[model samples]
Target: MTASGDGEPRPFLVAASLSGAADADWARAAAPHVDAAVLGGVALDPVSRAAARDLVARGRSEFLPDDPICWIDRGFAALADAPVRPGVNVRSATLEPVREAAAVCADRDAVCEVNAHCRQPELRAVGCGESLLREPDRLADYVAAAAETGATTSVKVRAEVPGVDLVAVADAVAEAGAEWFHVDAMDSERVVAEVTGDTAQPRADLTVIANNGVRGRRTLAEYAAHGADAVSVGRPTERPAELARVAEAVRAWREGELPAGEPPDRSEASP
Candidate 1:
């Protein structure tokens, strides 16, 4: 399905996490329960080739083909036949490659995410990840360039990065015409709240997807109250049972049927 309509509470977003294609499978299995699936932190530069080579040299990422785009495409295709709206998060050091990658998503009818949330050392070293958090101007330019591709654009940002003005960053992205703002709220719902609030250049079409430690119906409700158009769960959704539980909570929260209480105990969700 296409993304949730404006002002409507989205079902839920399976975060752009690192669970291989298992996350996509979870989305497919949970299709009756959720709204969207963000596929990857797919690297969009030559460094991706090097990263793949390193993984190949280490006998890891074995399921990944040599081409990173193929790896991303395979993940996207998994959800193509499912009802969940698909999105792909891409990390890039420059604009040209982001546009190229966004084009790929446009062709597949998937939103392309500019990933400023990844803090991997290799990615940061090359200015592809959290590095963008330190450069809001460049991040705006990157999102603007990607938006020009005509694919729906989403900017995924890590909100707790020291010295980064997340609200300013989000405002820049929204002003650049990004359709969605995804904030990895880290430890602060306040950050998500501030970013989702009306800014000097607010776009009524902009949707906020809040990502972080969403444990149960209560937590999901909290994010929604804090202004999240949708709430996303990352690592916790890897297990089918956990995914089911979160899906149940999301459904309950959406219907205002969630039992009033503290957040559900998530002891078993830890890896």
Candidate 2:
């Protein structure tokens, strides 16, 4: 899990949320500031790709390209010149499509994230995103298939999906051998902490990345205290000042200067 000899975890990541085709462009500009950039929420298979293309055609999508392969490839090229690690966040329902996308990521030596977080009706209708929450078996199979490709496999989960046992969901993903579990902690940081604590105490092999509403170094430290390996910024990255502040915080934290709260007791980490 350590990317270096010192056994230090990698710096905080910028979770996947760069829209469409222009994700590469955004990553190029943001690369110097973050440790990694996940280039997409890109649709890979023909059905999802068609939906993305249709959105672009209808002027509904600002940064997506009409051609699926071109869209992904262009983003890849953008990351090639980036100053940080490049990753791709892909949305798909079936294992074959994810395998195809994972192959592309493997070719580029980039991370491939399985998106189970998108809430778009169009995506849900196609059995992606929140839809997968109800189908843990399928989700496990999907991540397992992606991992078999030998690309770094990650799964983005929405922490509070209705009626879904997210902890169980995470266990299934980990059991399937996903190296990273990216949690979109929608209004519930405690849930993220619970998941992180559970994964850490027995076997901290899975890298738990806490996402959503992480605004500053304090919040970053807070998540760390909760056992997250890292915290991520999403909408806040749209603000330059906020992004700069977060970057500085990450630097300080990495250098062992950012003040962090005492790690939370795992018993209190219950969701």
Candidate 3:
């Protein structure tokens, strides 16, 4: 259930995210490779977060589930009650929904995150995801509230958002009490990989995680060295066999054989 660990906690190191493509078969496929499974970005509406969160929980076998964004308006539409962990991929720090989402995350012992990486056209029009990283001050406030919830607070940010100051944003997230940060290095065409190079590692205060296109232990190791405390996977868990491969990747990550890339120096981890 641990998302961030010191030296290859699971050998492969996978934090699988369950998106619309998830199901028992998919969950079963990804279960073996992943230590924890997080539900993909939801509508931030409470109902959306709650329903999505429940689905993630059900799909995951034993692993803990953390959902993204608790769509405020979607709360009433939730098929289930609120989950302990709420998700936030909001771009506007001043949005009132952020406050509502924070409160729900606090009340539920759930982990809440700020999704600063989604670039969906509709999301951009609404100013969510990557757009939020531009305003560190407001994002920090939301992170603080989420942390105050007694649940692990984290932020999943999309990189290369132009005016984005990686270090400053990471520093802000840390100062606000966030324990984990999700760095999406994937390119738009590739779903966030290919663009990763550890540019944001230096700014984090707590555990740093790299997502977007982590394939095997080699890639995981390269990321870990670049200052990641952990790494996550998304579409790979589309089915049972793939999920098993995901688990095996975690085991390999712990063993120190990540998919080939720039292997980060195993020096004192940048806290």
Best of the candidates, TM-score = 2
Any runs in candidate 3 off by more than 4 Å, and if so which? 1-19, 22-29, 45-96, 99-109, 187-205, 256-271
**Whose lDDT is higher: candidate 2's or candidate 3's?**
2
Query: Per-residue CA lDDT of candidate 1, range 1-271, in tens?
Result: 1346432356555545552453466567656655667776666667654653455575543234456567666767878788777777777676787888787777777788888886756567777778898988899898888888887888888887889888778777888878888888886888877876774556556788888777677677677677777777776656667667777877776666755545444453355
Worst 10 residues of 3 by lDDT: 76-85
Per-model TM against the reference: 0.84, 0.85, 0.64
Off by over 4 Å in 2: 1-9, 50-66, 199-203, 262-271
lDDT of each: 0.71, 0.72, 0.52
Model 1 gets an lDDT of 0.71
Candidate order by TM-score, decreasing, is 2, 1, 3
The reply for model 1, stretches above 4 Å from the true place, is 1-11, 19-27, 30-32, 51-64, 258-271
**Considering lDDT, which of the candidate structures 1 and 2 is the better prediction for this target?**
2
TM-score of 2: 0.85
**lDDT tens digits, residue span 154-228, model 3:** 788877778887767777887788776777765332322232233453343366667755654555556655555
Residue 46 displacement in candidate 2 (angstroms): 2.9
